[model samples]
Target: MLGERVKKLTKLMLTGLTMALCVVAFSPTVKAEAAMLQESEPNDNPAQANQLPLNTWVKGKMDDEYDYDVDWYQFTIPKRGVSQIEMIPDSTNTSGAGWEVSVQDVNRHEMLQISGRTAESYKLGLAPGKYYMKVSGIHQTFVDNTHPYNLRINYSESEEWEIEQYYENKNFSNANNILPNKKYTGNMYSERDVDYYRVKINGKQ
Candidate 1:
């Protein structure tokens, strides 16, 4: 009788342990948000821009209005990915000139630009390289230094994701040189949007 009781107790303990593990395994988990980063000084140009993280909030301020302070931030992607940039400005503002924010290439070529009130957003599709995020007081008119602005950047890594050709690629002006044994991904934006791709070979024929 004691042997049977001991066997039952062992089985009960095992069952209870299994049930506890199941509860823990199926428990809900909250994802931690990225940390907030402060904008550094002397980031007026891309050469001296602050390092921007992939997914983080950067608080910026135009400290010297007389100097026409320009805050520039730079970020680099290891692989092909899309970056979502959100520029949040002070809503309760009376200034006509808010801020001119842009993402530029290494050569200072503007990839995209955003200028408006509240939270302005832009989605950028880029290959692996260094990019710049410029928040400048260098404007035609005066920029609002009284109201501080916030910038948040989020990147979607797609090194393994295949470039889905959902829509037909009609344009081939910007030819893409793809590498072998590697996956490439690009956004077609929407159903109405189009994509372009090309493979060039320089073999002696």
Candidate 2:
């Protein structure tokens, strides 16, 4: 009887553990890890652009049919975070004249761009929104399927120290409420970009 009881207890314990693991596995706390991905065809335009995950490598090929052929990839972040996009071409065209990368907004407005056979850019204040990464040949006649490329992008969920990324407090009326003892961050993506903040104090010495 004791041996049978022990067997039953063991089964119950194993069942409970499995249930707990299932909960954790389906939990929403999971984050994307660095992984390899392949680009799907028909991703030549923003409308048909491939959905890219954060901190992952995606292999793709640019059209050799025309120099204007572009590969567009779309990605999103849960919140404001610093991100960098790196591009590497599998060819001997090491000069910056061969290819280019444009990080653009949902409307296809270029934010930051890098021109090179291979390159990457890093920065903060990348607003929380849908963005696109575009890669294409600058002006090379000798480009085609033989020249594939690898692209990777990733982002953090932290506001920059002393810099504001989705700075909605750009004006006095829409100023951001800040803390007295805490530091903030700001970044101006363009000349027109500005930052504003407001803090209240109480109890004077």
Candidate 3:
């Protein structure tokens, strides 16, 4: 009877040890899976603005943490130039809310604001200095975390060649006349229009 009781006790100990080992092996995997389901949050205010460089594009997202989420970006133009700022939302963003973009000078003065449901862009002649761009959802309704946007900045130093209206040169065959190494400005009234230019190259190297 004593030997039988000892065997039963040993079997119980072994069973408990096996169950503990299984728990230890699978706990980390369970925790890891839980972590993978969580989404990352972006910087919300101007104080955590992301720094951007000229002629570069960045990706940003909106989250549900706040009623209004604003993303800030800063860039510096080394010389007096024309700057083109563009913001395009992802097609997967089915949220009916639109977005707003605002540009500000280094002194915190608002320079320009663009708002609409579609992709938006702004071209302006800015002085050589630092500028900040603020992006937010319109009417505080943008809360889709899965969708992101693309922001780009393009700048070119002010050139001697100036053409205010190049509407007729919408195609390569009807390219606007221009001088080489000169900057020109033209109006892009609509999204369907393209501005084409023909530059005269004087000599070959």
Error of 1 at 17 (Å): 30
Residue-level error in angstroms, candidate 2, position 132: 1.6
> How far in Å is the alpha carbon of 82 misplaced in model 2?
1.2
Q: Write the per-residue lDDT of candidate 2 for residues 1-205, one digit (tens) a residue.
A: 9999999999999999999999889988976675568788787888988999888888876655556668889988668557777888745433333568888877666667777667877465566788888888777634344457788786777644333443333467766567888866655666656777778999887
Better of 1 and 2 by TM-score: 2
Q: Which ranges in model 3 have alpha carbons more than 4 Å from their true place?
A: 1-42, 140-146, 160-205
What does candidate 3's lDDT look like per residue over 1-205, in tens digits? 9999999999999999999999988886665422111112455655666787777767666664453567788788787557777767655667665678887776676656777666656676555677788878766555555446667777888753232222333467756577766666765544555566787777788
Tens digit of lDDT per residue, candidate 1, span 30-110? 346666687877787777989988877777777765637778898887776667778766444445546678877777756
Q: Which candidate ranks first by TM-score, i.e. highest?
A: 2
Considering lDDT, which of the candidate structures 1 and 3 is the better prediction for this target? 1
> Candidate 1 overall Cα lDDT vs. reference?
0.67
Model 2 ranges off by over 4 Å: 1-35, 91-97, 141-145, 161-177
Cα lDDT for residue 94, candidate 2: 37
Q: Report how far off residue 166 is in candidate 2 (Å).
A: 8.8
Selected candidate, larger lDDT, 1 vs 2: 2
Best by lDDT: 2
